[model samples]
Target: MGSATTHALAATSAALDAASGVDLDVATQLFTAARTLADSVQLRSALADGAAAPSARTAVINAVFAKEFAPSAVSLLNAAVEQRWSSDADLVAGIEELAVRAAVVADPSTDVEGELFWFSRIVADNPELELALGSRLGDASAKGTLVESLVDGKVSAATSLIISSIVRQPGERRVRAILTQALDIAARQRGRTVATVTTAHDLGASQIDRLRSALSARYRTDVSINVVIDAAVVGGLRVAIGDELIDASVSTRLADLRQRLAG
Candidate 1:
């Protein structure tokens, strides 16, 4: 993230934290507004141009979205436009992140992070599906319809909307990468970091709890674990928290041993 995007995100998060009565409705409005911005180059440029006066940007937001969005949603957009962004696309990403954050804040019971991770894994496991969703030749509306059919009843409305929005228009990013970014944003909204753990076998509840606790202690914040069972790991497990990887899997050890023997 560029400095401008970083600052904008911080400010938006603070606004979310301080707001009251934010719900899924607000998220839906934000998503719609984001889609509108993504589809219009002129509008995106108008709002994201750092050279434009902040007041002018705010006026544009009010003029375009005043009647379309709720007060809270419009207020959020107004705040977003006031900050400088690296690019128009970054502004779109910021809005997407805000939508996901709203979903997380609206309903504590829903597991948006887990839903996003599992969907990404599903795409990873199926080559045809990945190609279908990521192919530039495919129709955007068709891809969106596919997303809705697959996840509508299975996941929360918030999750479904977020997935649909990204797959329909993933600017310069793969579907899986976008899903992962959404997951990270969802985790951060709750003051937690996501730890993706891959093991050779499925872990039991107690084991998962213990691991979560251990990771939380290490990271000094709550950790959300998304477990993936992969037989290729052979044994043990691998843990990825952000860019840092803790590789204790048997396959990794064997690879290291082979390197030492060759030396």
Candidate 2:
């Protein structure tokens, strides 16, 4: 990340921490504001331009979004725009990150990271569903409705809002990728790390707890595990935490052996 983007995120994080009584409503409003900023080139430029006075940028934000968003959301956005951004795109991404953080802050007890990971896996398992969500020609509203129908009661309200918004506005990436990013952001908001673990079979509750404990000890922070059962893994497990991967799966070992033998 650029210095500007990093600074902007830091400022926004502070704003979120200071805001009281934040809830899913604040998150939804922030997400809506993000979409609006993303859709308008002029607005994004005005807000993200570092050369412009911070007061001027905040004024622009108030003029456009003051009435549309809750007081907390407006305050957060104003603080975000007051910081410098690397680019217009970064400004939009920063807003999205704040939205995800708002959701995490609202309901810290919910397992949002796990929900996002499971939802992404569900989309990955169904090619048609994935295509429908990622298709550029599809209607945005219809895609959002489909997401809501699938997850409304099954997941937390925050998770549903995050999924629906991403499906409606995935930009240039696949639905699964966007969901994964959201999951990571939510985990970070809680000062935890997310480990994506793939195994040949579903792990028992005791086994998962043990793994979580071990990973937490290794990383020195709380670890959230998102399990994906794949028979192709063929025993053992593949664990990914951030950019680090610990591959103990039988398939990976066999592939490495085969490569070494060929060489």
Judged by lDDT, which candidate is best? 2
Question: How many clashes show up per model?
Answer: 0, 0
- Cα lDDT, model 1, residue 246: 96
- Candidate 1 regions with alpha-carbon error over 4 angstroms: none
Candidate 2, residue 210: Cα displacement in angstroms equals 1.6
Query: What digit string (tens of lDDT, one per residue) describes model 1 on residues 1-263?
Result: 89989999999989888887788889888888888899999999999999999999999999999987889998898889999999999998898788889888887888889999989998999889888898878888798889999887889887887788778777778888988999999999988899999999999999999999999999899999999999999999999999999999999999999999999
Candidate 2 residue-wise lDDT, 1-263, digit = tens: 89989988999998899998799999999999888988899999999999999999999989998877888999999999999999999999999989999998998889999899889989999999999999989998899999999997899988998899878878898888999999999999999999999999999999999999999999999999988889998999999998999999999999999999999
- Looking at model 1, report the run of 10 residues with the lowest lDDT sum: 164-173
What is candidate 1's local distance difference test score? 0.90
Candidate 1: clashing pairs of residues? none
TM-score of each: 0.95, 0.97
On TM-score, the leading prediction is 2
